[model samples]
Target: MTRKILLLSVSAGAGHVRAAEAIRASAALSGEALEVRHLDVMDYVPAGFRKLYADTYLKLVAKLPALWGYLYQSSHEAKPDSTTEKIRRSVERLSTRPLRKEIAAFAPDAIVCTHFLPAEMLDRMLRQGDLACPVWVQVTDFDLHRMWVHEHMRGYFAANEEVAFRMRAAGIPATNIHVTGIPIMPVFGEMLERQICAAEYGLDPARTTVLLMGGGAGMGSLDTVAQSLLQIGGDFQLIVLAGRNVAALEALQTLAAQHPGRLVALGFTDKVERLMSCADLVITKPGGLSTSECLAKGLPMILNAPIPGQEERNADYLLEQGVALKACDAVTLEYRVRLLLENPAKLADMRNKARALGRPDAGKQVLKTVLGQ
Candidate 1:
């Protein structure tokens, strides 16, 4: 019999959606008798509510980071039945009526939630006896937020043993937690040829290459960082990926023209694995998905200004693992890059640590666990 699986995510951040996509791709490659459907919970909600659910988060993180950080901390500390949490949960339940309807219509054999919103809703349903199938949750970040904890989940997939430990501390049973690492696209597991990837990107395979990414929306100070990197004295090149940020792409292109063959600017390409193949180091925001991809590629990283909440925690874990360095500004970024450039052994050590921590088959492991295969 073909079992149906529903993969749910909320797109307040790209990492959640991408994690769901990775699991779906894994299901396809598993060759099991399975049917999988991935959905963004926002798509089923009303436009007004959808904007509030997704846009409000983006605005908070991008504009009022301090306030966002405060809220993140406060929410985590707040009791589950606190008035504020109760009101927020009520609003979410009322707004996600359409999503509930969709879930009922699908009637999946099992459900996997990559983001907390759907998982929270599903938890309520299971507790109320409105949902019959088992639901699993995947924590996309290294840190375990309070929002991800629920009493009714069949299992929880964690990015590391530390995250699993956190889950167990949160009162989850030991058997229900699995340290599967974060799910990234299977392509990151492949060992692409560096020379081929470099040729495709018109980069020198012999030169020290640094790849820069600003998350999926390109929400960082890429221009300033690129300029700072250019000032460093080194025999290296830069590949800047301005994801879905056209203005940033154009700005990078203009700057690339100033230093032809030394800098390459691109916008939202799916071939990030190939770029990683040709690079010695990555300068990027420490989003869970991007960091997981870098780890899978065994690429060392200089993490830039991470968003104040989960991203900050992600940076902390990478630094502790000796896989990355965190930079606060353009000056610091330049210094970190220069320090790594001047110390080949240090850079190599970081790369080795990254490879040791990499779970390239995490997606496959997720599938196997969920399917009991």
Candidate 2:
């Protein structure tokens, strides 16, 4: 009999959702044995609670960024038995009931959760002896957070060797932690011909193409990066993704008007893989999903100022792996980007390093766990 496989994920920043989609696509491809679905589980949470949580997150990270940084640092310093963890557990107790109800209603043979919320809910239900099937949690961040670890999970799919190591340090059984890189949609992992893709995108084959990304929310220092890149005068074209920030997109549109064909501004796009494939160098903030996507494309990364917490750790991991370079300031970023553009050897080295670090088969392997194989 074909098993119903439901991939559960929240839509906080598009990372978890991206992973879930990737998993669903692969699970669907294994013939008649798997019927797969991907859903935004947060939609089941009370609308008010969801909005408040998302809004507060945006406000804290955008308006009071230092406070957000402080909290992120504090989480690192927090012991397993911290006060925050106590309150977190209490909230988990209350919030998991709806999730439990949904799982019972759906009655899926296996459940794959990409975010901590669904993982916690499944863990809680299983601990209470109410779970009905196998549950696997795919950790999106390169650094594993305590929120991602809970008793009763069947397995954990991790992004890298470091994340697997961190999961073991967090006391998860090493045998249960699978080192699959962050699951990205198959497009990022596709064997696209780079020269053809670049030409189709109206980009130059002989020159370096740099992809400048704001994060999922399209949030970053775009104007500064754009200005800096333009100042460097490299034989390159810049493709900047402004995401959903209308104001940010409009601002870049205005600036691109001054630079002519050197800059191309895009709003929220489904063509990320297309852009990534065409680019030789990518400059962006170090969000885990974006980093993973760049790694999949085998493009060298020049990291701008990374947000605290997971993104900072991702930047450090990639830098340590020789897959990426970090720019301390905009001027330094421009200088490094220009120098790399001028030298094909350094670019080739980084490209090779990035490709070697990526697990292109991660999405495929994660779906195997989804099938209980």
Candidate 3:
């Protein structure tokens, strides 16, 4: 029988949406008789609410990280039925009526949520008997937060065993939790020739290459990091990806012109896999999707300025696993990069550790488990 699957996510951050897209891509590549739909819950909300919902998070994380971190911790500790929780849930329910209608119309055999927003709503629907299909939640970070948990969820997907262990400690049955790793797009699983990828980007394959990224919104001291890297005396080149930040891109382009072959500045592009293929190391934020992509490519990372909360937790896991080093500032980032550059054995060991942790086929594993095929 053909199966119907609905993958849900919110645009609060790029990881959740990217995780859903990864599963969709995996389904397409599987050549199964399955129907799949990926929905962003934010799309159904009112324009004002949608803007506020997404923008507030970005603003809080960027401008008031300490406050954001405190809120994150407090919310996790708060009881699910606390007055604040109820008020928040009430507001979400009122804004997401259209989403329920859409889900009813689709009538999926299985529902997967990459973000907690829709998962929480659907959990309510399930308890109220409005939704009959099983709803599975995929935690899109190395750490599991309370928001991703629900009493009636059929199962949970985790990025690592530690998250799975946390799920178990949270009273979720071990059988109901699966450590599938965070899903990444199928392209990262493919093998690409480093020389070819380097040539495609007008880079020299023989030179040590470093890639720097600041998530999808370009939210870090990228210019300072790039300049600091340039000051290091080494036979190496740098590639900086300034995603969706025009001002940053312009600044990087200006910097690139000053150094010619030593630097490559790029704006948003879909060819990140190619760049990863050509690089020896990556200096990036520890977003789940980006880190999973780096792991898939066996690219060791110097994790930089991770936003407090989930990202900080992610850096903790990566560092414990020996695949990454955390750099709290530009000076630390430069020092870490220089240390690795001078220590080829350490870089190689990190790369090997990354490869061991990389679950490039996580998307396939997710689909197979969800569909019971």
Candidate 4:
């Protein structure tokens, strides 16, 4: 029988959506007789509520990150019967009506969720006899948070075995969990000539190239990072990816114009693999997909300011694994860059660690496990 798979993701961050897309892309390349569909789980919500949810989240993260951190920590430790969990369950139940309606229309054979919101909703639905298909939850973070826990989920996918061990310790059955790493598209792991990539991107091959990124939504003080790079006394070039943020792109373009031949500014483009292939290091926020892509490329990372919650945890994970350096400020960033630039040995060590951690075949592993192939 031909199986249908519905991949659900939320747009709160780009990683979840990108993970879903990667899974779909991987499925397409598998030559399987499977029907795959991707859905933005948030699209099922009413527009007004969706806008309010997104705006409030961005505002809180921007203006009051400490509060977000407190809430994130508090929620992570919430018990099944805790007030936070109850409240979250109530909200998810109400918000998922449209999702239920869409599910009725699509009637997929199996469901895969990259974000916790939809995963929790579907879990609840299954318990209530609203859903009958198998539910696969692919966590997009390196660290496991309490919100992802659900008694009814059939499968759980983690970025690494440490996360899987945590899941096992949390009372989830060991057989239900798989350490597949995060599902990133395989293109990131492709071997390409660095000089050719540099030439194609108009970057100088002789210079130490740094790729500055803030994920797909472009959320960071990237222009300041670019200006700080100028302070580091080195022969280097910067390729700044100001992903969907037009204002950031414009500001960075102006900065690049001021420092001719030293910086290249770009908006969101599909050519990230080629760019990362040509760069020696990446300075960016440690979102799950971006970090996985960096690891797949065997590139060293300097984590700039991360968001207060999951990203902070992801940064810590990368640092603990010796694949990345965390820079809390412009001075620290400059020092880290100078350290890597001056000591090729350290740079190579970090790159080797990243290579060891890379899971370029993660998407395939995930699909195989989910499909029981």
Q: TM-score for model 4?
A: 0.96
Would you list the clashing residue pairs of candidate 1?
none
| Candidate 3 wrong stretches, greater than 4 Å | none
lDDT score for candidate 3 against the true structure: 0.93
Cα lDDT over the full model 2: 0.81
Evaluated at residue 349, the lDDT of candidate 4 is 97
* Candidate 2 C-alpha lDDT tens digits along 1-373: 8788888998877788988888877766656577777778667767766775566777776677678778877765677588877786676556556766767887898888998878877776788888768899999888877778887888999888888988899889998999888888777888887788777667776666889998778876687778778877656788899898898888888999998878888899988888888789998888777888888889999988776777778888998988888986877887888778888898999999999887766789988766656
C-alpha RMSD for every candidate: 0.8, 2.0, 0.8, 1.4
Residue-by-residue lDDT tens digits, candidate 4, 1-373: 7889999998876888999999998999998999999999778887766776666777777678888888889888767797766876787678779788888898998898998889888887899998899999999989888878888999999999889998998889999999999999878868988889999979988888999997777877788888888778878899999899999999998998999999999999988999998889999888899999999999999999776898899999999999999998888999999999999999999999999999998999989988998
Lowest lDDT sum, 10 consecutive residues, model 1, at 219-228
Backbone collisions counted per model? 0, 0, 0, 0
Q: Quantify all predictions' global Cα lDDT against the true fold.
A: 0.93, 0.81, 0.93, 0.89
Give each model a TM-score.
0.99, 0.93, 0.99, 0.96
Which model is ahead, 2 or 3, in terms of TM-score? 3
**For model 3, how does the per-residue alpha-carbon lDDT over 68-158 read when each residue is reduced to its tens digit?**
8998899999998799999999999999999999999999999999999999999999899999999999898999889888989999998
Reference-based lDDT, residue 204, model 4: 86
- Candidate 2 all-Cα RMSD: 2.0
The CA-based lDDT of model 1 is what?
A: 0.93
